[model samples]
Target: MGEHRDDLPLVLLIHGFPEYWWAWRNQIQTIADAGYEVAAIDQRGIAGSDKTPNSSDALTLAQDISAIARSLGASRIVVVGHGRGGQLAWAAPALAPGMVEGVLTFSAPHARAIQRPGTHLTLRTWRHVLTTFVPPLARRGLTDPVSLEHLLAEWSAPGNDGASSQAQIYAAAMRLPEAAGISLDQLRWSYTAVQRPTGRRYFELTKNAIEVPVWSVRGQLDPLLPERAWRQDHTFTTGNFRQITVANSGHFIPEEVPEESSQIILEFLHHVAHQA
Candidate 1:
């Protein structure tokens, strides 16, 4: 909330599903102006990024995140994500523990927690069930502006109309050729991917691999990923993680509350800097 007294570390933002770099357009400059080097990229398979539709699982996405950090030539980095990207933000620390200085997530639970056994607290209105199970139908019908609008509206706490700058960007991105496949891969693999031997081990091993401090930001208005998930924050990782719930916002907290989101991030970054 206050002006950053010292420059923070490099912070790379990864956007949620059905969106691109433009989704973070509102928060980018604001966070950058607070004295940290910042960059938000289109995750692979959407918008301007490459499309490895079949291979776009969370672990691979986390790899892309680490590679992006190295490409940017930053030594100490902080990873932030929203929605599906939030899952990757959780994995980034495990993938690049030494390189990542901090981890921050919005609108998503930690990957391992959601994938762990005996955990069945899904949000009230997760459209992912339909999207992942009925990919063909979802792809055929969801790209239409009306359907996209409905999807975003249901997910938002305040009910977005798919017209805000952020929602508009998502509406356009979800219509891309690779978008449907990417969306399906995201949630489908979220749990299924962990079923494989390698994935099962990755999920278990990384629970404690994330030693860097983390900040899990949630939208109080989120319909699909609501306050219930916050109860499991302690299970996200064995790292130092805290939760901050934003009001008057839904799944698209960054879009709806850019100023507040930026301040929360700056405060967290500053706190991490002082601790180091």
Candidate 2:
């Protein structure tokens, strides 16, 4: 967490699955030192946030971000997210136009890009996605520190010595009452949303090009998302957009390469500030 100043731009950091506000521990101070206010939040139903059953749909989650921004007294904010959180960041401008000044996403592509014809999910990614639908299996996996550690090691770039410790922390968080269930619910909704009317409306609303500036970053070694998932994302943005690949990194770019991530974020913040 950083000081909130009305004059300074608010950078809202939203974490992906199996992570809470602590996910941004590496970037928070760096951003604050650069003269920006930062707020890394634990999305609803995870960590300290309330567990509102069945409210993990895209529309609801986006609304939560908007509400948090407003509550923080921010007229506009730069949203930074990873994985599923990145998907929500992509949706923010469309769901709450004028509320988001810019977006910086890590390891996640635009929703349309993911749904585009011929796009495919890697087997590793599919395994995690499928686990969400199986409650017992999902819970078991999340609650076991060893399983989480294995996942982190698999998903992260080689030689990430901190992955095991991070997994232990995440495993402990997941053991909180109902936290595992909520996390699974969020993933489950992502997979089955297409069959629901609300999900259809959500996609429709975001069908148009994003008018705000966007920066998409991914680790070069990330196996979860292929290049095809985000290579053509420029077509979905009518405003300024850029794609960056961090060499030797993996799915968890923020933690895998904090210095580089911080540098990229600072550059984006400078761009957004000058653009405004």
Which candidate gets the maximum lDDT versus the true structure?
2
lDDT digits (tens) for residues 139-225 of candidate 1: 754566666666666677554543243444566677777776776676677758767765776576566646778889988777666
Give the clashing residue pairs of candidate 1, or none: 157-221
TM-score of every prediction relative to native: 0.88, 0.95
Per-model CA lDDT versus the true structure: 0.73, 0.86
